[model samples]
Every structure is written in structure tokens, then in C-alpha cells.
Target: MGKRFENKVVVITGAGGVLCNAFAAAFAEEGAKVALLDINEEAVMQNARMLTEKGCTAKGYKADVLDQESLKQTRERVNADLGTCDILINGAGGNNKRATTDNEFHDFDLPEDTKTFFDLDKSGFEFVFNLNFLGTVIPTQVFAADMMGKKGANIINISSMNAFTPLTKIPAYSGAKAAVSNLTQWLAVYFSKTGIRCNAIAPGFLVSNQNRALLFDADGKPTARTEKILRNTPMGRFGEADELLGGLFFLADEQQSSFVNGVILPIDGGFSAYSGV
Candidate 1:
């Protein structure tokens, strides 16, 4: 059988991460001309090279989504090299250490020596907010410009489980992803007349470099948080990267999801629906 995205032009941000890297490679294998964008030039290039070696049309570009000029330049290069972008995957987002609290609660009566909510760094909060929120906005502005009025144009934002319900200790990441979900709805309405569809995927727990330590111990045993996550998830395990590709390809192909817009699909193995019993 033929691939769903054959001969399409697809752009993915944060292409160096495990999830987005999987996205990039999968799209390439399906015969899409993949543009892998990431701040880590070497990592993005390596992934692109691997795809090319397997006879896929793939290219890597180092650009920060926070920088509009860099994203604009990347958009230009992608258009010149791979034709206009029909699919955009906004995958460039993560939590920073500063934005996280040492613990979930604040003891007002506790002494100042303890790390509490009062001890949370403002700079850390801002960093996560900007990276997760502005990162999505700027890239959408820059790349979606190439998709205006084009056939099969779609934008897929990478939201998180925190968007639906705030997670502990990571206020900034949670709130920012919430905003991403809101923006997805807003853009879908805004672009409805222009033939562009905007949607998002809210991924649940997945073991990646960003949270490997938090989810597992040095001996590779599941941590308390990981166990809690599994207990709360109806499927009882972390999701695999490839599991998201079906939703991705569905949103990317207009014929498959032509009327779907403003939807935030949760690829969370039932985590979003389950409650701990």
C-alpha cells in the first residue's frame, strides 16, 4: 500500500528530541520531504543524514523557534529546497529546571531555609513560559505563512497532559501548554476561511532524555512519580513515540481529517481519561 504522506512537504520543530526525531523519520519513510529543525544543529543533521541514507528526502536546519528571523530564514530555505510546506509540526517545547519547584507544596510556617514556593525563581518560570508558548507562536507565524490557501495545509502543535490538568511542581510548563491548546483552537477558527487547519496533540508520559531521571532511578527502576503515572493511566505504561504517528498522519492528510479542526487529541494511553482508584 502507498503511504499517506507521500510527496508531501512536512516541517517538524525540536527534531532532535526522541519524539520529534521519530516523527521526522516516520514522515520521511512515508515519502514526505522532511525538514528537521532544531537548535542542536549536530543532532538534527545526524537524523537528517540517517533519513537520506535510507533514500528519503530529508534536510536539517538549525533554527530557534523563539527567533522569528531565524525561523523566517528557515521557511525561505525550505520553500526553495522542498517546495511550499503543507504540514507543520510544532514540536519545539520542554520544561526548564528553573521553572520547576523542588516540591509541590508551600509551607508558609516553614523557615526560610527550606526550598518552598517562595523560593521559586522568577527567571525559571519565564524561561519555560517563553520556550513553550512563544516558541509555538513564532514558528507558526513564520512557517504557516507558506501554507496560506494551499491545499492540504495543516498545523499540528505539540501540547501536553498538563494543559488539561495542571501537574505538580511545573507550573510554567503546565500553563504554557494550556495556552498552546488555546492557541490551537484560536488559530483553527482564524484560519478556517483560508483552508488551513490547526490542531494539537497532547502527549502523555513518554520516557525521554528530558525526564528520564525523574521517571527512573540509576538502576533503571521506575521512580515514585513513574509508578504514580502508571497507576493513573488506564493503560498502565508510558507511551511509545511511534504511537503518536497515526494521529500525526491523520491531521497532516487533508483527505483523512479534512473537517477536523480545533481538536486537541490526547495520545496519552488513557491517562487523560483515567482517575486513580
Candidate 2:
């Protein structure tokens, strides 16, 4: 049997990260020529090399999602090497510590010595917003051009569960991902006639290098917050990176989901559906 993405071209940003890397490998295994883009030149190249070793057509590009010039150049190179991008995975976004507060809420009964909202740094807020929001927009602007009028062309933006219900400390990431979700809908309508579908995947709490410290303790055990997450999640555990692959393949394959657009599919193991009842 032929692969689902046989002879297709797919671009994944932040392709070096664990989750995106899983997406890249999954797509490549199905015969897609993968363009792995990441700000970390070494990491992306390493990922590309690993894919190539597996007899997959893959290439790595060093492009900062926040830099329009770099993104345009990278897009041009990708087009020249692989065909016009048919599928784009906007996976290059994360939260910074600066925009996150140490505590969930402000303590009113403190002796004038508690860290509060006033402690939030301006640069931190800007960094988180730009990284998560603009990081997505800039890449979409550069790559979606290749998808215009192309059959089976689609774009998947990566959102977070916090986008639907704001988490405790990371306000900026929540808002930015919410904007991403909203943008996904807007673009779906904006490009309805162009044969390009726009949608988003809101992942629930998943353990990664970015959030391992927050989710696990020094002893490699689940933290209090992690416990809370599992308790609220109907699945009763964190998601594995491979769990997202099925939804990704469905969205990327127009034959499977031709009518699906402007939707945010929460691959959170029912975390979004549960109300902690």
C-alpha cells in the first residue's frame, strides 16, 4: 500500500523540538519530503540527517520564525529543493519564564514583601508574545504563498490548552495561543477560495524539555501541578508526542479531511472536554 503522504512536501517549523521532530519523522515515514526549519541550525540539521539516514527525503534550514527576511529566504530555498510547500506545521512556539509569575496569584496578606504582577518584566512579556504569536504569523505569511491554489494544501498552527482556559501563571502564553486559535479561524475563511485550509491543534499538557522542570520534580516525579493536570485530564496522564500524529495526518490529507477547516482540534485526551467534575 502507498503511504498517506507519498510524494508530498511538508514543512515543519521548530522541527528540532521533540513534538515537531515526531511530526517530521511520522510524515517522512509516509514518503513526504520534509523541510525541517528551526532557529537552532545544529538541531535541525541533526534531525534532517537522522531522517535521511532512514532513507527519507529531508532537509534542514536555519530560519528564525520571527525574522521575515530569513523566513522568505528559507521558503525560497525550500521551494527550490523540495516542491512548493503543500503542508505547513507552525510548531515553532513556546513560553518564556519572564512572562510567567512564580506564584499563581497575588497574596494580599503579605508584609509588603511578596512577588506580584508588578514584578513581571516588560521584555519578558514582549518576548513571550512575539515568540508565540508573531512566530506563527511570520512563517504563515512566507510559506502559505506556496500553497495558494494547490490541491491538498493545508496549514496547521500549534496552539495550547491554555488558549481555551487560561492557566495559572503564564498569562502571556495563554493570550498569545488564544490569538493563534482566533487567527486559525480568520485565515480559514480568508483563504477559503484558494484551496488552502487553515486549522490548529491545541495540545494539552505534555512533558518536554521546555516544561520538564515545571511538570516534574528534581527526583523525576510528577509535581503538584502535574498531578492537578492529570486529575483534570480525562485520560489521567500526559500525552505522548506520537499521539498527535493521527490528528496531524488527518488535517494534512485533504482526502481525509477536505471539509475540515477553521477548527481547533484539541488533541488533549479529552482535557478540554472535562470540567473537573
Candidate 3:
């Protein structure tokens, strides 16, 4: 196939993170002008530098997904630098330690240090929820404006497998991702008339910088949760970040998926299908 995204302007939030950085590189390789947006200025800039070194058109922008003004400003810069946006990947969302409970289930007379759902910090819960949910919304509101009434315009939200089935001890992340999935459907319907397809990919357990510690111990042994995840997954292994690119490419390519919309595609290792029976 020729360059699928030649001259196309693809913008991705959370591009500083491992998964989204890979997405940026893939888009750049496909001849798209990739704009990497992240709050971590240094990280995104380094990623952009690496891609540019490889002769790809890419630039990094320091953007806060929760801040509409910041995104709007970044949108102007992206528009001026690389033309209008053809595809937007809402890849900015994550969990926080404060929002996550210490134990799977609450028990009476638990240790004071043990954080139950009731003990969850309100600020942390709001931060996590807003980051995943509002983070998707604010950016779309700003960037999708350029896509209005334009053919081949689309939005891809990064949801989590927990969105389909809530995981224990991380209620905030699960709930936020679930909301993102729902918003994807809502956006699809809302933008159908405008020719902007909206969809989401709910990733399974992936070992990335953000979750590496959770998956592995200092001794490099699999953690308890990692073992449980593998046991539940039919594929019996965690997914690689690059493994998600195909689904994203399919969704972003208008000709390939013209009729695909409001779909929450799961890139899990059949984890959603298993029942532990």
C-alpha cells in the first residue's frame, strides 16, 4: 500500500507516554504529520526529535488535556504548522495511586493504612475521572472543529479493558474509562451528520512505563496481578504497544472503515471473553 496517511495531519494527546509515543512514530512513518501533545514537555519533545531525526514530519507540543485553553492554543499551532487535523487520537488518560484502593474488597477493622473505596481521596478520584473523561472531551471540542463537515475526519479514544468489565481496586480508572467508551458512542451519533466517525480501543494489560512497576517486582519477577492477568487471558501474555497500531490504522483510514463507527474495539488477549470457568 502507498502511504496511507500522506500529508495527513494526525494529532495525539498523551504522546509523551510509551503507548502514544509509539502511535506517533507509526503515524509519522505512514507519512502523516504527527503532532505529539503531552503535559511532559521534555518527553514529547524528545519523541518528536527522534521521529524528525528519522526524516518524519513530527512536532511536540506541551499541552494539558484537561485545559481547554491550552488545547485550543495548541490546535492553532498545529493548524498553522501542519494544516488541519484529519485524525485525533485521544490517548491521554491514566490512574492515580490515591484513587486506587489498597485491597480488592473492603473488610471491617482493616488497617488504617489500607485505603478502601470510602477512604479514596476525593481530589484524586476527580483528577483521574476528569483526566480520562474530560481529557477526551476538551481536546475533541478544540481539534474536531477543524474536522467539521470534512470527509475522512475521525476521533479515536483510548479506553481500557476495565471499561467493559470493571477491575478491582481501581474503581476510578475503570469508571472513567467506561465513561470514555460511552462518550465515543455518543460522539459517533452526534457527529454522524458531520462525517466524523468516533470509536474507541480498549487495551488489555500492557507492560508500559506507567504500569511496569505494577506488573513486575524489583527482582524482575511477575507480580501477583500480572500472574492473575495472564491466567485470565487466553493468549497468556501481555500485549505489546505496537500491537494496537493496526486497529488504530484501520479506524483512522476512512476508506477502510468508512462504515465503522460507534465501535469499541477490544485489543485484549480474549480476556473479555473468558469467564474464569
Candidate 4:
């Protein structure tokens, strides 16, 4: 069978990170010219080098998702280097340790060092919120300009399981991702007339370097949080980052999902369905 994305230009933000880096590789293997954008210069450059060495047409660019000017400049470079983006993946988002509460529930006699809802840093909250919500907004504003009239142009935003129902101790992240999910629908309707489709993928508990400590102990035993997650997940396991590829590929390929728009497809192994009942 012919490659699905042959000759397409795919741009992914947060391409330096593990999940998005995997996405970059997948797109390249599908015959797309991939553009990896990340705030970390060294990380993105190294990833780009690896892809290029593998004979994939890929390049990395340094661009902060929150900075419009940085994104504009990166867009110019991407157009010159890879052509206007046909698929834009707004994957640059994350939570902050300071913004999260130490305990899921409030304790009147909590330790002084313990962070609570009241103890959450305002700056940290803003950083996390902006990184996820505004980060998605700004990148779409900059790159969607190029996709205005292009055939099969679309955007994929990253939402989280916290979006559907807020997770404990992560108010900022939950709120921010909820905004992302809402924005996905709004963008779809707004761009429906402009020929640019918008949708999102909400992933469940996937253990990565970012949350390894929270999920498992140094001795490789499951943490309390991990147990809770597994119990709630109908699949009784954490999802693999590679497992998200099927949903992504379905949404990005116009021939397959031309009629699918404004949907928040969850790749969470039934986490959203099981209500602990």
C-alpha cells in the first residue's frame, strides 16, 4: 500500500519530549517531511539529527510555544525549509510540581513543607495554564494562517484525562487541559468554513520520565497513585505512548477522517468510561 502522508509537511511542537519525539519519527516513517519544534535548542537539534541520519526529511527549530514572535519566526523558517505545514500538532504542554498539591485532600494539620491548594504558587499556576492553553492557541494562530486554504490541513491538540474530570492535586493542569478540549471544538467550528479541521486526543495515565517517580518507587514498585489509576482504568494498565499513534493517524489522514471533526477522542484504555462503579 502507498504511504499515507507522502509529501506532506508535519509540524509538531514539544518535539524534544519523549511522546512528541515518537510522533516525529512516526510521521517521518509515513513519508512526511517532519518539522520538530521545541523550546530546548539542544534537544530538538539532537532529535532532528537523529531523524536526518535515518534518511527522513526532518529538521528541528527552537521556538517557545508561549512566545508569538518566536513562533512567527519559526514559521518563516519552516516555510523556507519544509514548505507550509499541512499537519500541525500542538503537543507542547505540561504540569508543574509547584502547582500541584502534595496531598490530594486538604489536611488541617498538614506539614509546613507540604503544598496545598492554598499553597499553590501563582506563578507556577500561570506557567502551567499558559503553557497548555495559550501555548496551543498561539501556535495555531501562527501556523493555521498557512493552512487556511490548503487541502487536508488540520490541527491536533493534546488534551489530558484530567480534562474530562479534574484529577486530584492538579487544579491548574486540569483547568488548562479543559480549556484545550473546549478550544478544540471551537477551533473546529470556526475553521470549518475555512477548510481547516481541528480535533484533539486525550491520553490517559502514561508513565514517562516526567511522572515516573509519582507512578513507581525507585525499587520499581507501584506507588499509591499508580494503584489508584490502575484500579480506575478498565484496561487495568497504563497506556503506551506508541499506542496513541493509531488515533493520531486516523485524525490526521483526511482520506480516513474527513467527516470526523470537533471530537475529543480519548486514547485512555477506557479510563473515561469506568466510573469506579
Best by lDDT: 4
- In candidate 4, what residue range of length 10 has the lowest lDDT sum? 107-116
Q: Write the per-residue lDDT of candidate 2 for residues 1-277, one digit (tens) a residue.
A: 8989998999999998989999999999999999999999999999999999999999999989999998998999998999889999999989888788877777867556555578888898899889888998999999998789999999999998998999998988999999999999999999999999999999887889999999998999888899899999998988999888888888888899999999999999899999898
Ranking by TM-score: 4, 3, 2, 1
What is the C-alpha lDDT profile of model 4 across 1-277, one tens digit per residue?
8688998999999999999999999999999999999999899999999999999999999999999998999999999999999999999999999799989988788888987888789999999999999999999999999998899999999999999999998999999999999999999999999889999999999988888988999999999999999999999999999999999999999999998899999999999999899
| Worst window of 10 by summed lDDT in candidate 2 | 108-117
**Residue-level error in angstroms, candidate 3, position 230:** 0.4
Which residue runs of candidate 1 sit more than 4 Å off their true CA positions?
108-114
Estimate the lDDT of model 2. Answer: 0.92
Runs with alpha carbons beyond 4 Å of true place in candidate 3: none
How close is every model to the real structure, measured as TM-score?
0.96, 0.97, 0.98, 0.98
Please report the TM-score between candidate 1 and the true structure: 0.96
| Alpha-carbon RMSD of each model | 1.4, 1.2, 1.0, 0.9
Clashes of each: 0, 0, 0, 0
The residue-by-residue lDDT of candidate 3 on 124-172, one tens digit each, is 9999999999999999999999998888999999999989999998999
List the pairs of residues colliding in candidate 1: none
Ordered list by lDDT, greatest first: 4, 3, 2, 1
In angstroms, give how far residue 222 of model 4 lies from its true place.
1.1
lDDT, candidate 2, at 252: 88
The 0-to-1 C-alpha lDDT of every candidate, in the order given, reads 0.91, 0.92, 0.94, 0.95
Q: 3 or 4, which is superior by lDDT?
A: 4
